[model samples]
Target chain A: MEQSMKPDGMEPRTSSLLDWFTSTIGRILISLFVPFVTFIVLWQGFLFLRDSEAPKLVIALVAIVWGVGGVAILYVVSNWLIEQLPSQWVRRLQPFVFVGPAVAILAWYLAIPTIRTFWISLFNADSSQFVGIQNYLDIFTKRFMIEAFRNNLLWMVIGTSFSVSLGLLIAVLADRSKFESIGKSLIFLPMAISFVGAGIIWNFIYEVRQAGDPQIGLLNAIWVGLGGQPQAWTALLQPWNNLFLILIMVWLQTGYGMVLFSAAIKGIPGELLEAARVDGANEIQIFFKIMIPYIMGTIITVSTTMVIFTLKIFDVVLVMTGGQFGTEVIATQFYRQYFSNRNFGLGSAIAVVLLIAVIPVMVYNLRQFSKQETF
Target chain B: MDKKIGSAKRQSRIRDFIVNGALLLICLIWTIPTLGLLVSSFRSRDDIATSGWWTIFPHREWVMTEKIVPPPADQQDRDQPMTFAGVTGTFEELREGVEQDGKRVVWIGNKRLGTVEVQEYKWITNANFTLENYENVLSGKRYQIVQGDGSVKEEQGDDLSGAFLNSLTVTIPATVIPILIAAFAAYGFAWMKFPGRKILFTLVVALLVVPLQIALVPILRDYVKLDLNGTFLAIWLAHTGFGLPLATYLLYNYISSLPRDILESAFIDGASHFTIFHSLILPLSVPALASFAIFQFLWVWNDYLVALIFVGSKPNVQVLTMRLADMVGSRGADWHLLTAGAFVSMILPLTVFFSLQRYFVRGMMAGSVKG
Candidate 1:
């Protein structure tokens, strides 16, 4: 028992129930119990405030206090309780105290819901009956689902490639230039805008009017300037319109890739480039033989991230086309199935399919994380 | 050797020119769409409809617009005097009046120019910019309705003020709460030791890519059952959950890498884990905390998906992105309002982004590279 105890020699030699209560094990259980009860009470208070008929501003104020202040107090109180325990018990129980709320929240919110969604995927439309594999079958059979799959493929391939390559290109060019910061800042600005805002901003560029009418849209104005007829870029074209929508995402995400790649490029040892140049490698050869090989890990990281983003691309399509003209992607299809069509089974199945699609990249990412020994 | 040095210098100069020119063009391409939206938002609706936003600079142009209308049934004769558009004159005299006045005019044409056709020409200069769009959006459009007694009554119109408040209410707590929670968790994952730590943390990492759609249905159903739907608390909790993985991951990278000797010395000096964390770790982790704070702030502020499903469509509780989207759907052709609304939604994020950009970039780089 002493061997298991901390070497700090702070343990009290006692065995009675009340004395045990002050012992390490007793204090550990008490610490956990106190925080749990306090959390419950705080949760009840939050619920009371939420359902209360109080004014919104008052509720908002109370909530800020409760949210920010309550979290701080909870941490302080829990950590203080853990401190009251003997050193060994504190060591064993303290990690839980620190990581428990986060792990519990993750389990409750993300982990549990993910499992529940998978279960719902096997059930019928309202989740009233178990209809296994039928919804999954429909994902492959439905025309809209097929289109969504096709578009998602296009988004994953085209969007990810363009964003990554363009990001790499710009990062390489602006690596040490005088205007690097300003240029990257300008390019990076769109990443700050929400996808919905990006859709509207791009709409002005893609806006079309009658050929003879002065084109208010920048794209059509330029098109008309070049003697081409002003065409509805997003609407009048089939298959190609998907590319138009994809461009908005590329615009928003390229900066993310550029910033990441720029960091990775900056990490490449200057001596490597200098040696390559001394060995008669030109800029192009240096980029390919040296820089690209150097940042391959970052490239994969960025590509996998973009792949996941493009697979679940929703806001842009929903805002721009509302999934019209065969522009439906998987997330939009799931939204349509559940929200509009009221087909919970189909929607959950679609969501699960998206989950499955991301699993490969996710597993790849975990391997990378483990490879980096982040833990 | 002199000639060779000169040629090499010329080659490098040309390379520099190409590089600068390419980036300049790329920046222009990136900025022009947003610039168009910004410029278009300031112009009057008529001006926006008639010409491109690019026409606002250089020399203002005089544009002549012609509208043809059928002559009134009572005035079909070639020489009949006509009253139209507050002008009264015969066909021949109206032409003379138009030439003399050189203002907008309504001219009834003679038989050769089609007797039944009346031509109205207006020469308007495109040289106007106004803050009316922003005023209309921010202050909410107010309309004066003239009653039968000719008294004007002002009525309220839809603006973004309420939605703006709701977004703030959702964002502030959501951004803040996650940071505290994740910071504590990160400190544990970094410094503290317990069983199942590795597996538990791997679970969090694996969750980083779980599409939020998987959680939406079950959470929505639970919220409905709990009667927590459409409340700020509901969204706060939802965003907290969704945002935790990245937060933990990023903060873990920072907190774990802190020089171990400091923490070890603190422990040897009889500081408890809690005290050390509060005093030493918290202060040291501000950079990481700040990085994650900006990340969560921008995300919560700009989010539309989680807000739409969780916050629901109640007008008072709607967010800026939701309101902006609704404007796009309902007022699809209303470019002025849409542009202004989009700008409004973008302003806060853009400001936050530009102000704390270094931390933001540091956060992004750290997040991708995993330290």
Candidate 2:
């Protein structure tokens, strides 16, 4: 079996220690040991350089060296070691060699921390005392948390629907128009801006001042210009401020949805639309019957993606209103609880609840992914 | 029949007009907010405060009261101090007198209670715009405070340039590191057969949606233990960890779809998996890599939550997003600075987005469509 697995070019040499060291089992063990050691040594060097009173430039240089160059070298050396192994051992171990570092990092960074978050959710603010289910109860019962849940529900439903519908509307309308690409690009431009940036832009639009003070915010400026009293838009509007906040997300994400749906719409065969038209279907009927059905998969895809986005909506809330005046959502609530309030247990619970809310969409997404791969 | 055909053509043209008009209106509405901000950033602070950005275009005469002092009390006009409103002075006279004390103060009535500069000049000026806001915000000029004694003192504020650099520092490595790691894992998931591959791949796909919020406190606790909190390295690792699942998933989709024959031929030629990946797969996956690079770049550039949690708002390490948010918190009323600062932070991502828009759209589809 060993002989069969050997490559064609070279005969196995077991005469010397160096030859033994180059053998399959020896190389596998070395491959396992060397990369780990190299990573540790380099990582330690980096930390040491960072901690020392070294010059900023020197530390930055070392960081680049360790982060990019060192990581690449580690991988290369490990791969070289794997190549020294016989074909059978190489096939068996090469996958591990390729995948092991990523898995290790993921385990360290994600899996472990996630497990730890769950564990910490059972404890109090500083994780000093174990108070199982108490934090979860508080999250479920507290007025703020309840408001957060309600607000999140509002955001998810309204924000998702508006973005998807607008996106679909624009996608359908803009198709085959003379100004199609230009219109789509204009709508899609917001996707480039960060949600935080979008919030700042929208905040200017929603800004309000004293009645006598010039109305700087566009909404108020228009309101005051039209003979109506200018009110603080985000502040005065009760439950609707959440809708206003959702508007920013809608603005930002509609572009995203439009782009995706536009691609999907363009993918629809012209023959189908022509057939529907010839059958005496009007534009609206063809849209509902043929176009909508044709892109229903895309609609679901876009909506679910936006739903996931709306579920984790944080930056916009943080920037626009700081979750004040009845605009608190789960992500901001979690932030305030953890960072401002310093309630670790409750924060973790909020996070867990968010995790719970997102899991179904994620599961659906994964199913879609696997289904796509199968084809 | 000819008349009916003509009428139908006209009707359809009208319908087309309405459809196009609605789309055009929606497009304008979508873009106007950003346009307002951009215009606001360039306008004078007073202009931003007093009028809407939309008011800039129309040519209108604005009667602005410019304070100017009378040429140091000439004996003839000593009793006639500069009036607050409608000061009797030419533009050149006001400009000349204001150049002396450099203090443009207001004059009340004919009594010279103090040396005050008051001048009223009328001019039909278009939109008053200045780059001062950008300069002030970028240079970290704090809001000045007028003390009880009428002395101005500068408060300490965040340096936008510093924060911008820190964001770049945090972002570039965070973006690159994940792509490298994920590419390898993606290659494994794509081509190499291993035990538990299916389960591990599924786990990665599942982890794609695991809220980074869930990982925050626990990882932060660990960072505290490891003394990694608030470090650039810490944020990089955190970002890499959070970004890995999606990166791996996207790259796996792209890599797995590559022609199997190329890889098989490489295998038959006795090329090691490493060599094939290095020479063939990595180069061939450039498009996929470029797409993910843009995704990760934009994600890291725009990320607020992960950066906030792992890298606290320390001056030296605070990113642009965190710093921009801080500015909003501290200087909420300073819309000029906020607008300018927001644009400054947005410039890089906007450039990336516009330049690589095609790839960005592709990345978005690859990220969402299959998922």
**Which candidate comes out best when scored by DockQ?**
1
Off by over 4 Å in 2: A1-45, A52-65, A84-87, A366-375, B61-125, B140-157, B369-371
Clash number for candidate 1: 0
Give the Å shift of residue B104 in candidate 2: 27
Show model 1 residue runs off by greater than 4 Å.
A1-58, A81-88, A275-280, A369-375, B60-127, B144-156, B368-371
> Chain B alone, TM-score of each model?
0.80, 0.79
Give lDDT tens digits, candidate 2, residues B1-371.
Answer: 99999999998899899889999899989889988889899987667767778777764432434533445555436543334344444333443443223233344334433344543333444478898777777765576745557888786655787677777778878888888999999888777777888788887878887778888887887889998888878888888888888888888878888887787777678776677788999999998888888888888899888888887856667888988888888888878888998899889998988899888888888763321
Give one digit per residue, the lDDT tens place, for model 1 in B249-276: 8888888888888877776776767777
Q: Tell me the deviation in Å of residue B200 in model 2.
A: 1.1
TM-score of 1: 0.86
Predictions in order: lDDT: 0.82, 0.79
Candidate 1 local distance difference test against the native: 0.82
